[model samples]
Target chain A: MSEFQPKIVAFVCNWCTYAGADLTGTSRIKYSPNVRIVRFPCTGRIDYMLLTKAFASGADGIIVSGCHPNDCHYTSGNFYARRRWIVFKKLCDFMGIDTRRIVFSWVSAAEGSKWADIVNTTNEEIIKLGPYDSYHKLSTQDILE
Target chain B: MEEIKKIARELLAENKVQVVLGFEKGTANKVRPAFFTKAEDIDKLIYNEACIHNIALYLKKDTCQHAKGVAITATPNVVRSILQLSAENQITEEKIHIIGITHEGKCAGILDFKAAEEFSKTQPKGLKPEDKALIEKIQAMSLEERFDYWVEAFSPCIKCYACRASCPMCYCGKCNVETNNPQWIPVASHKYGNVEWHMMRAMHLAGRCINCGECNRSCPVDIPLNILSYMLSDFVLDEFDSEAGLNSVFTSALSAYTVVDKENFIK
Candidate 1:
């Protein structure tokens, strides 16, 4: 059959990665078409549950990007987001979730090319990882008899 | 045991506290939570190692909330919970009295919040040996194996919510599971719903669970829910150097942050 194309969900903050992706489009920087972006007010606004929801909804990969440290528009939102992701990432790892499929990054609005690079590289990695079939089987199924 | 009863009697006799939350003999020699309001009723009060239940959860109940003054027989776990709750502003120091029981099951007498904080810190915080073994086993599995492991582990859940009810930290009036507007969590106890409920529960309690193991004790299916929270708390401590139930001024690591937090994983 044809090559596998993973469905990647990108959760980006309005002030940074979303704008960065917009810049990528404006600058005509071509990246993988595999990613779908979801914008939030701030990195702090991107509830960690959304990440799980993405996975449970058959997303093969996820990108959570926000402002760099000291660069958040709301001052400390990214900082708080950073602390949360550290523990959240650890818990996901401990729970046997394929944390490798989830990418956490900082993409300032100026980093248009950087956002494209992130999308492309993450797409390649997830292509190698293949579909998140195991997770899909577990969460989407109704129940065991 | 008499020391606790005597203290309870004195507190009741002097009208110091409206109720003393402790344990009493139950049917089949089991110890159950018993609240004493009368001085003479203090005769039923008891304290033993079997009293591992985190009685701190009672503070939020109507019995304690409506009372002018309250005292609780606090094991190490209960003391930590009391401190954590106070730090979260769920309750105040002046309203609740802590009858401290150390890790050794000895009554340390009534302690103020300051002493309770110290008592919590000094108590042993290691995971039970069996729990440690299971954690290690889960950690050793490949990612797929771990996912399957949890699926199987949660398969027997009946959605009884005993874990949330027994946990002192899960004090939300209407849990997210109850919100059907968007249906954040599935209401059914099926495999998928069970996993989602537990993941939601774990994240909510990430920086808050005090390693009390009451959730496990309360689970009818005996799912290893406690180990999940324990692992999360251990990581929170190792990475953030903050712990729950250690201080009354409770800002969990997740709720606050340093600009310099480790983020090597962020690409």
Candidate 2:
């Protein structure tokens, strides 16, 4: 049998991290192929509920990437996202969600290499964290109609 | 008790408020929320330790909303709810009157928005020392233990929504769990489904839950979900230095941010 392959989901902002990943492709910077990318207009648009939903949808790990502070195309989107992250991380930790499997980062449009590094390191870390069946099982569990 | 009754009577007699929201004798010595439209009905208006229910939730109901003015028996928790509601633009100060009741069961008389702020600051927050110790005990556990603990804690939820209904802050016309389009959460009350429901509730109530514990009180299964909100409220204060219920102008930490907001977690 083959080794376990973790299913990773990368929720990225259109302006920064998406462009940065694009630059990674153009620059021939290679990273793990385990991740599936979902794009949003800004980090502020990414709801914390989506993070929980990702776990339920069979994702072993998640990467939430956005523009760096003072660099958001929309001025205050990243700022709001940052404040939200503080509370979200605490609640996730308290609720027993393996926050270690979720990665948050600042990847600018110019930081393609940094994006690649984030993906590679997060891939290695998630592989070690193994499957998220604890949360994933909730979705697949039989729901009475 | 007579002081509150007299106050309610005066408010009704002077046409200061169309409805006086207080408590009346329920079955078997229990107290139930009672609305007094007539000045004479103030005789039945009662306030005591048994009147622990957060009656502030009625301020949003049709009876209170349609009234020309509302005078509510505001506990510290209810006052916090009212201030938080006003901050969210759910209620206006001019339409509602707060008859402040101290946590000790003494009436502080009628208070406006300004006086309510002082009353809230002086009152004890709802977190008990035992609950604080429980929070500490849970925080010390391993990540997997914490998860299993919550899963076990929320396993018995019937999703009766007593928690949401009792919560004055949970005034949304349609809760996310009820959204069937994407079906953000399941409506069923299965074990893990209840866990997901609680996680969503905790996150949504993060900075705004004034630690009222009404949700825990209203839960038929006795799920201690209120502790989760109390923990998040402390974290919100420590991280953002912002809290709810004190000021009408201040936004919750979740809804607002400064350029210098801390982000040591994000790489």
Candidate 3:
């Protein structure tokens, strides 16, 4: 049987996780190649709606990583993002979204290995969950007519 | 009902307020929002369990905005919405007078914002048992089952937006959904679009929703929409220990955060 390669999307902050992912590349770290990264100025800039858009656009899994608490380049952007994710994660779970498919983590500029680990772990988890056909079918269906 | 009408009449007769916003019997045994401009029109006022509409939403309307002052019949949730609105600087204490009603069908009399705040303190808060039960039931489902449940529930949405229109907190002049220049949310009633719309609605109202349940009551599809906000409200209470409309002094959960705020889930 063929192996399943899950499609993953990573919404990362430019100041931390993005730089960390960049460091992962420069440091010769091998991680899952399945993830497509989208960089924003800060984690707070990553809207919850955009996360839904990622799923709608066929992403089987999502990784939202940013600076650690009090480490936001914008001072408190990650702190605010943390609170948002806290509520958003609960909301998603309550609405029946496979929140395990969405990973939240802290990947500082120095944590290239941590970034790689998160990617590999999220990729492995998503692969086990298989294709996100339920959401995929929902996003593609024509309900406006 | 007589007490409410008498107060409305006195408010207009004494020139205390230019209008009194309350509810009246609609054509189909339903209670409809009524605006009383004349002292005689106060006779149309009705206060019953069926008069559950949160009339504070009208305070944002242009007609109400231009009025010199307004006297509003406020249920517990309406009082909370008013307090939240006042805290948000949408309304002022002198501009509107509150006519509070108890859950037991009694009048609490004309109250200033201060008195209303005190009155609201005594009112019971949090989700009703039925709502909590439904939330727990959904929470008990498997992820796949939950997804299908919401899909089936939200699929019938026609993008009518009656929920948003009925919501008191959704008073933004230009909602995110209306900004077509960037087209933030899809205008279609499709499944994905509906889910995004509802999620955004709930997120936007997370800490601010007064648990008025108007959004759910107003949905033409019977989509149990209030459960989302109720869940978020409970989260705000448990995680932040903050309740909306409790007093106007505290910052909303999303707007302000402390260093001590709990975020154990983040690595």
Candidate 4:
């Protein structure tokens, strides 16, 4: 029997985590190959609906990373995004979504090692949690109809 | 009820307001939203426990917009919605005259926006014990169990959007669900669509929901939809120390962020 490998989606800000991931590649940093990264101009641009769509698209886990606090290129986009995540995380937990599968982190363009670490650790955690069948079931049911 | 009618009569006869939005006895023993335009029709106004509909929503209607001013029969939550709406600039304070109703079923008489704000502040701003208990019970369930519970609760949704229509705060001219150029949310009422719609509704109302329970009350399927928004409201209060509808000039927690905002979850 083959060992299960999870499909992960990473929503990263182009100014930070996306550049950090690029740095990771250039630096020859080893990380999990399971993640598929989606770049947005800023974390503030990543809509909450996109996160759910990732799950609906068969992602076993998600990584949402952006600039550190007080470090956004737009001065306050990350701050606004942080506030959004706080409320969004609570809503997800209250609605019984497996919020554990969604990771929130700060990885700047200088933090190549941190970007690799987030992806590798999130991949392992999602592998242990198995397939995200619950959300997938919802998406497949829509197709069946 | 008579006091409400008397005030409605004076407000109309004096030309202080061109219309009075209140509740009246509907067919089938239901008290539904009623709009009184003439002093003679004021007697049709009714106020009771069954007068739970939030008539503040009518103030945004095209007919209500044409009125010189509107006098609305406002419960505590309805008054709160009015304050929140004023803060959002959706409605002007000068255009609304509130007839407040106490929790004890007494008429508080006609109040201007300032008095209405004070009235809402004086009212208890906590979840009802029953709603708190139900939320705690749901929180005690395992993740899989809670997911299944919501899926079952949402399965019966027919996408009528009576919840959105009835919400006083959901006064958007173009709702995200109605936008199809990019189709932010699916139009169908399938499992995913239902959950997304409800989540969007709850999120949009997070700090703004006044816990009027109108959404849940209006749901044809009896889906306890208000609990989600109420829980988010509670979350905003506890985490940000900001409460909606307390002041008409206050900033929303989601729209306004500070350098010192709490964020332990970020790495």
For model 3, name the residue pairs that clash. none
| Candidate 4 C-alpha lDDT tens digits along B1-267 | 788888889989999899999888889998888888999988888889977777778888987899888999888878888888888888887778888997777889987777887899888767779899989999999999998888888878999999999998899999999989877778888988888888888899988888888899888899988899989999999999888887777788899898898877777
Q: Model 4 segments beyond 4 Å from truth?
A: A142-145
Please, what are the lDDT tens digits per residue for candidate 3 over residues B1-267? 788888889989999999899988899889899888999888778889998888899999988999999999998989999999988889988889899998776899998888888988998877889999999999899988888898889989999999999999999998999988766678888888888888899999999999989989888889999999999999889998988897856578998777777766676
Interface RMSD of each: 1.2, 1.5, 1.3, 1.2
TM-score of 4: 0.95
Estimate, for each residue in B95-203, the C-alpha lDDT of model 2 and write its tens digit: 8889999999999999999999999999998579888998999999999899889888888788998999999999999999889998888887876678778888988
lDDT of 2: 0.89
Superposed on all Cα atoms, the candidates' RMSDs to the truth, in angstroms, are 1.5, 1.5, 2.0, 1.7
What tens digits encode model 1's per-residue C-alpha lDDT throughout B1-267? 788888888988888899999999999989999888999998888888788889899899999999888989998889999998998898988878888988898989999999988888898986999999999999999987898899889989999999999999989889898999888888878888888889888988988999989999899998999999999998888888988988998799889998778868999
Q: Is candidate 1 or candidate 4 better by DockQ?
A: 1
Instruction: Provide per-model DockQ scores.
Output: 0.78, 0.75, 0.67, 0.74
Docking level of model 4: medium
Question: What's candidate 2's i-RMS value?
Answer: 1.5
Q: Which wins on lDDT, candidate 2 or candidate 4?
A: 2
lDDT of 3: 0.89
Clashing pairs in 4: none
